[model samples]
Target: MVNTPRLPLLFLDIDGPLIPFGATPQQLPHGYPAYRSRHARPAAEANPLVTRINPAHGPRLMALPCELVWATTWMSDANECVSPWLGLPELPVVDWPETSESSDEDDRSGLHWKTRGLVDRAAGRPFAWVDDEITEADRRWVAAHHSGPALLHRVDARLGLTDGDFDVLGEWLRQRLEAPSSKGVSPASP
Candidate 1:
C-alpha cells in the first residue's frame, strides 16, 4: 500500500463563519442584498447562507492554528468582496485539480474539492475547516469524524469565533507543532 501524507490546513469561510449574522457596519458585497433577497424572506432563520459577516474579526484569522486559506462560495471572488473589507491581501485561490470536470454551471459544492486540494498540497496532512453551512453530514464524512490530527471547526455564525476558540485551536496546533507525531487529544468543542 502507498503511504498517503497529511497536511494541516485552515479553511476560512467568509459569510457565516468569519462574519456574524446581522452584524452592523457591514460592507455590502456587490449585488448582495438583492441577490439574497430573491431567496428567503427577510429575517428568515433557515437561510444560513445569507447571513452577515463581521469585518472586525478578520484580523484575528491571521493567528489561527494552521495555514489560513479562504473557503467560501465566493471562491476567488473573495479577492474583491472580502479582501478590501478586511484590510488584508486577497486570499489565495484553492483550485480544483486539473483533471476535474468543468462546466458553466454554478454548482458551488467546492468545499470538498478544495479540501482535497489542501490535503494533497500538504501531502495527505490534516486540516481544520471553518464554514457556516457545514452540516452534520460534512463533519461525519471528513476523515471518519474522529477529530484526529486534522480538525474541523464549525463555528457559530452569529457570535463569530471568540478568544476561547483561538485558545483551543492554538493548543492543538502547538501540541502537533511541538511533537511531530504525538497523539495528543484535543479538547472537545464547547
Candidate 2:
C-alpha cells in the first residue's frame, strides 16, 4: 500500500480574506455582491454582513490540497457564522496567546501578532497562510524559522480572495506536495 503524505495546513483569516472590507467606490463600482446561503441560521440572519460571504468559496476552499484552519479573531464564532454561510464543516481554530498589552517594538519590527503562533502550529509541516495583513517581514520570519516549505500569500482587503489568489495558492501547494521533502539538506551546501 502506498502511504499518503499529510496535507499541508492552510491558515485562513476571516476579516480580510473572507469578509472583505475597505473597498472604495472606485474599486467596486457595483459594490460587493451579497450572497445568501440556504444553510444560514436565524442567528446569522441578525448579522447582515454574513451575507457578504460567498457560498461558492466553500467548494473552492475544499478543493485545495490542504487542511483548512481558522486563524481569525472571530474564534469559535467563525465556525458558527462563517462555516454555515460558506457551507463548510467546522474546522480547527488557532488559540491565540493572551497578550493584553501591545508592544510597540513588535509592531515596529513589522511582525504580525499571529506570525509566531501560526509557525508553531505548523510544527515543521508545510503550510500556507492567507491574510491581507501579511508583510515582507512575516515572510522573512517564516522562511528563517520554519523548516518546511511555507507560502504566505497576501490578499488585497478591498478585493478579497480573487481567482488569481486561488490560482497562486493552488499552484504553490500543488508544487509543494509534488516536490520531495527536504528534511535535513542544507540549501547552502546543495
Candidate 3:
C-alpha cells in the first residue's frame, strides 16, 4: 500500500475574484455577462450579482492541481451562491476569527485581516490566496511567518480573474506541486 502526499490548497475569494464589483467602462464595456441557466443550489432570494460570475471558472478552477477552499467573507454563502452558479461543489469554508487585539494590531501594521487566518488555515502547508485586497504587507507577513511556499496573488476588482491571473496561478501551483517538499491535505478537486 502507498500513501500519496496531500495536495496544496487554493484559497479563493468571492467579491473581487469571482463576483466583480467595480468594473469601469473600459474594463467591461459590455458590462458583466449574466448566466440565465438554472442553478442546483439556488438562493432563497438570489442576489442579482450571482449572475455576473462566469460559469467557465468552475472547470478552470477544478483543473488546478490543489484543494479548493472558500476564503471569502461570504463564507458558506459562497457555496450557496457562487458554487452552483459556477457548477462547483460545496467546498471547505474558512471561518474567520472574531475581532481581537491581534487583528487590530495587524491592521495598524498594514497586514490584511485575512492574512493571519489564511496562514492558520494553511497550517504550514503550501497554499495560494487570491483576493483584491492583498498588498505587499500581506506578502511580507506571509514570507516571514509561513514556513511553506505561498503565493498572495491579487486580482483586479474591475477585471476579476483574467486569463493572465490564471496563468500566474497555474504556473506557481504547478511548480509547487512538482517540488518534492510540497505537502498538504487530501485533494478536493483535480
Candidate 4:
C-alpha cells in the first residue's frame, strides 16, 4: 500500500479571519453581514458575534488540502464556541507561551506576537497562516526560521476571508502539494 504524505498545516485565526470587525462605514455601510447557523447550540446564542461567522467557511476551509489548527486567543473557546457555530469538529489549538519583557522587542520590530509560536508549532512542516496581523517582518522571520515552504497570508480584518484571499491560499497550497517534497524533510518533522 502506498503511504500518502500528510497534508500541510493551516494555522487559522478566529477574530480577523472568521469574525470580522473594524470596518469603516464606506467598507460596510450596514456593518458586517451576520450569518446564522442551524448547528449552533443554545449557549452560543448569548454571544451575538458568533452569528457573524459565516457557516459556509467551515466547508470552504475543509476543502483546502491542509490540516486546520486553531491559532487564536480564543484558544479552546474556538472548539467550544466557534466550531459548533461553523459546523467544524474539534481542531487542535495552538498553546501560546506567555509574553516576556524581552519579547516586547518583537512587537516593536513589526513581528507579530504569534509569528514565532506559529513557526515553532509548524516545526518546519509546510504551513499557511491566516490572520489580519501578519506583516513582512513575520514573513521574513518564518522564511528564515522554517525549513519548509510557508505562506503567511494576511487577511483583511474588516473583510474577513474573501474569495480573493481563498484563491491565493488555495492556489499556494495546491502548488505546494503537487510539488515534490524537500529532501530529508518529513512532513512529520518538527
Candidate 5:
C-alpha cells in the first residue's frame, strides 16, 4: 500500500483574515465592499458582514500549496455561511478548548488564546497561521514550541487578505513545500 503523507497545514482565521472589520471612514470611504459569488446562497440567508468576504480569495487560497484548516471562533458557521462566499469547500475546524484561568493569564501576557492549540494541531508538521490577532508574542511562542518550520502571517483586520499577504504566504509555504521536510515528508507528494 502506498502511504500518502499529508500536506503542511494552513490554519486560517475567518474574522479578521477573511472578513475584515474596523476600517476607518477614510479607509473605506464607502461602507465595506460586497463580493458576489455564484456559488453562494442568497443574500437574505447571510449576515451582512459575511458579504464583505472577497470571493476572489477562494481561488487564491486554493492555489496555495498547503492544507487549509479553519481556526476561528465562527467554527462550523464559517463552513455554512462564509465558505460559499469564498467558493471554498468545507475545511477541518479547530475545536477550541474551554477558556480557563490559565487562558486569562495568557491573554494578560499578550498571548493569543489560539496559539497553543494551533501548535498542538500542527503536531510537528510544517504549518502557517494566518490571523489578524497574531502578535510577536504568538510568533515567539510558536518559534519556541513548534518543531517544524512555521509562518505566523498576520493579516491586517482593516484589509483582510491582500496581494501582499498572499505573496508572503505563497513564498513561505512554497519554500516549505520544495524543501525536504524534517518529518521525512517528500516534497514531491501530490
Candidate 6:
C-alpha cells in the first residue's frame, strides 16, 4: 500500500460530532444540568444537528496535532455560539461561496460549500474532515477533489471526541508521519 502523509488540517463539525443530540437531563457537579435540553438539536434550525463542543472536552481536542477548524453548516453562527462556550478568544472565521436562491433545507450541497472553504484554506495541504454527515459519496468526492493525505473520521454524537477517537486519530497521524515522503509532499510538521 502506498503510504500517505500526515494531515495538517482538522475539520471539526459542531453539532452531532461535537455535541450530543437530544441529550437527556443529567445533573452536573456544579448542581446545574451539564447538558439538559440546552444541548439538543433544534429541528427548525438552519443546521439543526449543530451545537457547541462541551467545555470539559475542549482542551483535549485542542491538544491534537492538526490545526482545528470549525466546519459546520451554522457558518458564522458556529463562530458566535462556540467561541464563548469553548472559552476561546475567537473562533476561526471561514468563507463560503455566494448562496443561490435555490438553496433550501433539502439541499445537502451547502455542507460541501463549507468543505470547499476547507479545501481552499488548506492550500494543498492534507486534511482530515470530522463531521456527522460525511458519507461514502462525500468520501469519494474528497478523495477525487482534494490533494494529499485526506481522511474522513466520523464521530459519535453522544461521545464527541472520546479517548478512543483521540487514540485512533493519534495512531493514524503517527503512522502517516512515519511514512517516507514521496511525490514531494512533505508530511505535516505538526
Q: Estimate each model's TM-score.
A: 0.59, 0.83, 0.86, 0.84, 0.83, 0.64
Write one digit per residue (lDDT tens) for candidate 5, span 99-177. Answer: 8777987878899999999988888899888998887778777777888878888888987887788988888788876
Displacement of residue 8 (Cα, Å) in model 4 is: 0.7
Better of 2 and 5 by lDDT: 5
- RMSD in order of candidates: 10.0, 5.1, 5.2, 5.3, 5.6, 8.1
Residue 118 in model 6: shift from native, Å? 2.7
- The candidate 1 region of ten consecutive residues with least summed lDDT is 102-111
How do all the candidates rank in terms of lDDT, highest first? Answer: 3, 5, 4, 2, 6, 1
TM-score quality measure for candidate 5? 0.83
lDDT, candidate 1, residue 167?
A: 69
User: Which is the winner by lDDT between candidate 3 and candidate 6?
Assistant: 3
Say which prediction, candidate 1 or candidate 3, comes out ahead on lDDT.
3
lDDT of each: 0.54, 0.78, 0.79, 0.78, 0.78, 0.57
Segments in model 3 whose C-alpha atoms lie over 4 Å from true places? 24-44, 180-190
Q: Report the C-alpha lDDT of model 1 over 41-106, residue by residue, as the tens digit.
A: 432453344335334455666655456777666777676656655555766756656545522121
- lDDT of model 6, residue 105: 32
66-96: candidate 4 lDDT, tens digit per residue: 9999999999888988888777889999999
| Predicted structure 6: lDDT | 0.57
Clashing pairs in 4: none
Off by over 4 Å in 6: 1-7, 24-52, 99-113, 180-190
Which parts of model 5 have CA positions greater than 4 angstroms off?
A: 1-5, 22-41, 180-190
Residue range 40-128, candidate 3, lDDT tens digits? 23532566777667677888999988899999899888888788877789999999999888987898889999999999999888998
Residue 174 miss distance in model 4 (angstroms): 1.2
User: Which of the numbered candidates is closest to the native, going by highest TM-score?
Assistant: 3
Of candidates 4 and 3, the better by TM-score? 3
